[model samples]
Target chain A: MVLDPPLPRPMIGRLVVIGLGLIGSSILRAADARRLAEVSVAYDAEPAVRARVAELGIADEVASSPAEAVKDADIIVLCVPVGAMGAVAQAIAPHVKPGAIVSDVGSVKGAVLNALRTHLPSGVHVVPAHPVAGTEYSGPDAGFATLFKNRWCIVTPPEGADAEAVQAVTALWTALGANVETMTAEHHDLVLAITSHVPHLIAYNIVGTAADLEKVTSSEVIKYSAGGFRDFTRIAASDPTMWRDVFLNNREAVIEVLGRFTEDLIALQRAIRWEQGETLFDLFTRTRAIRRSIIEIGQETAAPDFGRERG
Target chain B: MVLDPPLPRPMIGRLVVIGLGLIGSSILRAADARRLAEVSVAYDAEPAVRARVAELGIADEVASSPAEAVKDADIIVLCVPVGAMGAVAQAIAPHVKPGAIVSDVGSVKGAVLNALRTHLPSGVHVVPAHPVAGTEYSGPDAGFATLFKNRWCIVTPPEGADAEAVQAVTALWTALGANVETMTAEHHDLVLAITSHVPHLIAYNIVGTAADLEKVTSSEVIKYSAGGFRDFTRIAASDPTMWRDVFLNNREAVIEVLGRFTEDLIALQRAIRWEQGETLFDLFTRTRAIRRSIIEIGQETAAPDFGRERG
Candidate 1:
């Protein structure tokens, strides 16, 4: 019955997951499977999602309220959208254990850091984290136990964050199958602004443009999307509330990066207009090298066609 | 083989594929495997690709040159890059079989149509086709027989073209597992500009922007690419020569579409700058609907996470 060796459980005695969408439910599933905590509790604003999590038996307890869920928890992970982080943290702050490590899974850490500093209780330690992985799908059903496998989780701890709390949170992510790296909140926001936020804005804009084109019907766009356009649709399909908050909260970094991207795109437009083949060729070649490196190291290049090929 | 049911072969005596790249070799493999043609012949400008196609036995014969490849071929396809299409047609024109049907797998049809009309010899029917399917990978070894399965192939026959040639080409695509539709060359270019060309440009431009960020190193960009940026890199990694030619040949349409996309992007960028959450949210939600439609009809939504799950 017990053929495999027992895994070393992390020191988190009670792990509370607030907001039961993709990231929240995934954390619960991973913590349960990996035995990262002694017991797990969950709370989602949506009753339907709470019911689904209960039906799936993803957590040991499905709480009626965030306060009830984190009443005795040693670690509380806020899993709500970035816009809801401040309120969620404020609501659960009063119930958290005196030395509880409060953390969040927000894409933009600088804003979350400010939110945590403003809303969370003084005694509860705040260590903001961002797991740089997702699918277009959302809700509890979209979560899987291994979603974090081989993914990066950047922990953006404040300058005066508790060292023990930060280390413990890092161990928890490691136990849940993520590689953790520590950085400042400002640096994290700048890096993510370039990597995730602006790219998402561009994708959302293109899909919007394609849909609104009078000359090309939306059906035609859908039919022929397999050629390059569909690739953007995947990321564009990410939860709107989450992205909306990301842009609002990380306004400065996003605007800064968006400005740069706009400049590059305009230059490209000029080259295309003037039939500058060599310029286009050079950029395409350089970008191809970047993808090659991403594929080789990140292993994102495993399946050709991004695995869209059904046959 | 003896126990298997005999397959009904599609018409056409010889299908000659010029340029053994992803689409070219894929056609040869699909044709040979489906018995769509009695025999398939191929030639590539690159000697190594020719040798590999011959060694892989993907084609019945691998000729030394495009001219040799199309001699007596019933269907001759110029599969070279779009910029090279005119020259490829001119090179193979002298040896083309009398009354033979010539076609292509270019992304932009109007330019290809013009190239065909100008360079192809008389008595050789030119029916430019764009099979709206591909993986990011290029080269002979990257092709598979099932690449065209369930994909769409747009056949843009010129005015007053031979009816039998169009029907035979449609049948060939159907046999190789594609849904065929016919449209004018002008309409094809416009639709493809929105669907494929502009999207490729955005992908290329963003990847370049990410790489050139002075604050975030390239390694960081690649490592954290799973956050929306990785999707762009997949399309950006496509063949440089092919994409450069696509931009050059389809410059006016592409520039026109890019102007619209840039306008939309700047609007979104302004929304972000001014903290227009509702505008961003509405656009993001609408785009999600577009992706759902693409998933429903195109059936490209298989395997969540765009098949980037590392389990």
Candidate 2:
């Protein structure tokens, strides 16, 4: 049996990518690889990023502004921070072509959906999405065509959203090498709060602690990081503004999960202080099973030591 | 110049290893691969582990007891947990010949040193070391010869120890593919408390929290772990018994560091609650440099996401 080579651009009409950071740049590069659109244009507020995008030829055209980028586009993916969503929608609304499907790759879906609904033109089909894929690295140079391959892209189309628009957005993400699923913005925010936001918060807090220690020098932490602290640093090193926005926008969910995390931590602290070996053992043993489940579900590698050997 | 393929066990002495778990079995396999010892013997509390070691030909002989394994050996390595150090030392004291170097690979040095000094016979050079390398897996089946390659081994020799014995112990680890450095037992504990013990405690605590959540399902935690939580689960999945022993044996140091960690975490929590975006950004940006230094020092790869790919 034989299969035809996937076309570069599976979707028709213009695809305007706003913001040329890691996610936005990757989207353009991937679509260009397969010629996924009849026309591709991108805009980044940062002139340096815009110039770099022009240099890389990542998109068919680099627009001078968001308004210009989506002038005749069938889809406009606002890959800006959650805080920037409303402003970006406002900037592009006047120029967004009627019947265009508007989406985003923000982490906080509920807040982003609110912003899109508030500022995007009534005719624009609002389809807020969260692509749960990224590296700590950011910027145009940090992105690659395969960044979204095998990653999950959750599309949250509010009630009464255009079904055709939602389908078009899902199909676009699928073609970009992602697995797409639909859920409400509220559920997406809650799920991500526990899965991503709080974990990142914990990592950031710990790394900060390690750095600010008085007796234990920072040099010592870096030298012996292979012990465990190094892994936390990777997540903690993620884009600061982006994460800050996530925590602020999803405050209720983040606070709720963080409260649970604090309670569990206090109990473990008590166990350690009181020498309750059995309690620690039970908890540790249970957590090990979670790691196996993650590996089995294809979210992580089963390789020992995270397969961290130089490759 | 040719290096003679680094003789499989270049040291001229019989190596007796007690406890055949991840670290123990790795030591045996590495020594055998390089011929770093003349003849190697090992003993484990578990008969199944002993049988497997013999089956794999990991050592010259699998002894029935620690006393028997160290009877005629010039060097005896205690690879058991920190809590088991004292009893194992007592068992081998009468059998360990004078001038024989007694060493251990426990993570907590101060406690292990105290155990060695009290239980082992006089004139037996005592060396307590930690090869800051391991995977989540344990047991003989999880061992590998290259486990210590490019890893750091902290050799904490007691004050006024035999120079010759210390040199022999250092040579053994260096030949087995670890970079060896010497420090006092007290200092090693303090450093490891921050670098390893507390980090593991946090990982275990977070995984436990995520699992015990009422609102967030365990299944969701596993499915979406790639966002950030998966890395913590990796560290948390480490052998529970080994970590429990570490925390107990290094109680003072662990408590001290854990205290600082709690304080810092509380401050971050406050900042988050108050919407102090600058505070969060400052911490997130600073942590990124630590990751860079770890990668630059060769302890970790600069690869995005710890180089965790489909493999």
Candidate 3:
């Protein structure tokens, strides 16, 4: 007994998920499970990943290369790291069918679009998508069908771009159970710079710092990491290639936000050094509100332990 | 039903958990559920909290003052913030039953002991305990009986301290399923300053900085928080009063570790600004091992989405 009317039948054609890593493989599985596409093809450079593609049964077809993956695909998703997007775009541009739509699952959309704009053949639609969903794990085997369920997927379509292509990509992600939002690439970079890149970089930096500490033994760090450092380590443990490309491609926005972060951190350092309990308390209390808002938006879980137990 | 022989139970007459906050209430619940103690009493300074204490039906007895709570208790646990330990100890010391045990749930052992040592009666044994378990939430209702399960509890007993009292507390925490470890006060402060205090302070600082960014709106921060800052906000949102006391009490250790953290953060900041991909990748990769160790120790759970599913 359904309370609401049934959802409309989704509109999607042949879809391709590039660089079959955690996100890529997950999207493939998610699309197949949701029946979002007639055919889904996955591609990766590494032979092992490609071999695992056959083993996992994620995609209907496994392509030899980026070009092969998008040869006849209507919706081509560049699921590789930001650093590899340029080369993959170059390789696939020549083979992209006319009227075909191209999108990506890259973290930084602005850079990805910029890299692909020159190589992409005319009349082919390009919509940069960032499925704001991932895990600490990587590689093909790490993916699951439920990865994109109820997550946010930001679609950055170029100004005055093909409306149909945008609609097709949006529908594809929507069927995969993601709430899609469209924004300008520049705005997306700036927003993501604060929300994703800077936070990840900070986590990486803190964990790196902890690792390099001379006074504290690594064993001690691991044993006593039930504290705040463990959370950073979790974030810091994400795929290195993905993060490297993220920082490289989103340089300007990352730097700008990082400047703000550094200044704020220094101010906090001063407060701690001076024993300013009021400032610390005020900041701590204020951040709690932000967490609550995230929970409200349904971007983060409301569980007390953040659903770690189920995971 | 019991495959193994029942573990020997220590004879702990009555345990009073002062301040029905996250730690206190949780300890009371866990102790009572495990039948680790004959009786469990809870106390909070605020009448509202005391009234709610009765409402929760967790404690065998609820009291508004430390003196009333510890009056006839065999073990009086000061579960209040580190800053308030002195006052709570003073009020309860005179009323604590002769030969009773006095302990704490504060992070910093040396400071808590120093703060409350002078206030205790000659016969009352002081054994400082720091159970390394918590969430961002606080207060009586936030506590759960399983909060201390599988967590680490560091106990620091003074020289010539009552062996029986220390053993009883250790046994009780063990019964509650916490892995108990004993260390000197100085060592405990140093370890915690790095593992908990410094990391928490850094998290609070970073989140505050993110909140203050003018170019990036709070809405943007919350919307895109899935990348990494979300984890920091969770850690930073921990009780302000409790953390303030932690930093204030463990000044030297916190300062020393904080200095190391700042130096490391600066180096990473430089690397990011310079777009040094190798350095970032190398540093980021090394942190993964620590995360694996944490998962192995059962301190953290590995997740595919790391709690980004709700949104």
Candidate 4:
């Protein structure tokens, strides 16, 4: 079971990651660990986060401002929330290098692509990516170097975008141990709506419903959560502002998928009401195959209860 | 961090487990590991499962028939589905010894309590319990001795039941490494409906919805499931027959909780449709505290992603 260390791949001359949150700090840490870039810089709007990132020493240099962070960088990654993509692009536009590739790690690609295109300078390329990986915890302290390892990193380059820029972005994610996929922004949004966005919305919605129950005490819900409700709580515990922006920016796609979800749920509710055992059994049986498929593709763990330690 | 071994307590002279599924097999394994019962016997309706249990060697004896299983047992815990509880109870009623205790590990307490009380002999005491623990995988091979370790085992004794019989059932669960809680069958049903039943229904419902999407391919859903959909798939992958019986038996509580869930979801849908960022943020923030409480109380793991090994 002995394994060789990953060889350092010095792809970019200078890499700057703005917004030192979970994904941001993770990118910095992974870049340092893998030597994906020659020099790495970090910046965050919050002075406290920038100081914390500096203290953690994941980045070679902690920049004081968005403009300063991107001024001499070959690639600038905007890891801020989806809603803040435009403002961060605008803030860094004036100082960004002419040939620098401007990228983002937003969940919603369509809005983020439009935001980056409208704000960044003409010579600067825009490449938006959504890494299909995360945890419930957020912030710099919650991140680690292997967050993207063995995870999917989806790149949604705008139509008629530069190929070299796209390739560079893809290679960076690849060197950082991610399986990269490229798709249109619209397609990416629709796919993520069913796969990620709507799931998170429903999880948050269910947790809220459970918290406000009058017949059941909150303590009871918390105590017996191992049954199933605890899983939703984990997803619902994700960063609030980031998820808020995801729902806000991707409203159309989220609403469309959610409508379908409610329609299917209503049918299930009717089946439960009518005591249709066969219908429930059939749906329950079919869902197991999807879980198997995800595990087979190495997208999820096959361990029971996610390999959680039992006392 | 050295810990002492759990002290063995011989609580029951002869224990018979009638279903050999996940919960049933785990009970036998835990009983054997802790020495909670002097002799543990097992029987499953499915011949294949009974043979597998014998091969696993978790029980002292694998009985061939219902009569043979419970003929001389001091405590018989029926681990069959809620709908099958009565039939299993009735099958062994004529052969059961007088003054023996009959208990069950069914998920729905109220219906199971009713079924056991109606089918068991007059002198046999009925005490139904539901351990609020399990994995998505089921059957004999999917279970382990520590499945119930540090988990909650809720006991719902029939009204005016024998005091010694209730104590015996509670002591058995405690000796098997579970925290025992006593409550009325009605309250247990209500609590579990929110915590387990409805959560499972919605998980099954959402996975079905995602599978039926036209714009998003099933392969895409499986590839990008790590966002949040994968968590739901785990719950949805639970045993179909067991869950079908749970929804059918706990129809009232599940429907009531599901109604609240839909109402809350509609409000959330409206908020998203109207771009209410603050509304989403407020609820998302509040849900994080419940997750913290569940972890604090030891019902859930504090590790990120349930401590799944990262590559």
Per-candidate chain B TM: 0.95, 0.96, 0.93, 0.97
Pick by TM-score: 3 or 4, better one: 4
Ranking by lDDT: 4, 1, 2, 3
Q: Tell how far residue B175 is off in model 3, in angstroms.
A: 2.4
Poorly placed runs, candidate 4 (over 4 Å): A1-9, B1-9
**Candidate with the greatest TM-score versus the true structure:** 4
Write one digit per residue (lDDT tens) for candidate 2, span A1-311: 11124594356689889999999998998888767898899999999999999999988889998777888899889998888999999888888878988999999999899998998778889998888889999999888888788778889999999889999999889888888988888988888888899889988888888888887789888888878888888898899889888887888888888788778777777787898988988887888888888888788888888788721
Against the native complex, each candidate's DockQ, computed on alpha carbons, is 0.62, 0.60, 0.56, 0.74
Give residue B155's error in model 3 in angstroms.
1.1
When summed lDDT is taken over every stretch of 10 residues in candidate 4 chain B, the lowest stretch is B1-10
TM-score leaderboard ranking: 4, 1, 2, 3
In order of appearance, the predictions have TM-scores of: 0.96, 0.96, 0.93, 0.98
Docking class of 3: medium
True-vs-predicted CA distance for residue A275, candidate 4, Å: 1.0
Better of 1 and 4 by lDDT: 4
Classify candidate 4 by CAPRI docking class.
Answer: medium
Best by DockQ: 4
Given candidate 2, what's the lDDT at residue A78?
90
lDDT of 1: 0.87
lDDT by residue (A1-311, candidate 3, tens digit) is 11112235435678888888988898887777666777788889898999999898988999887777887888888888899989988999889999998888988878788888978988789888998878889999888776666767899998888888889888878777778888988888888888788888877777766777776777777777876668788788899888988888888888887777777767776777788888878887887788889888876777775755621
lDDT of 1 by residue, B1-311 (tens): 11112147557798899989999998888777767777789898888888998999999999997778898999988788988989888898889978899999999888889988898877999998999989889999998888888889999999999999999889878877889989998888889999999999999999999998899988889888888788888889999999999998888888888889989988887888898899999998999888888878964765677765453
- Tens digits of per-residue lDDT, candidate 3, B59-151, equal 888876777788788888888889999988888877888788889989989978887788987888889998888888899999888777777
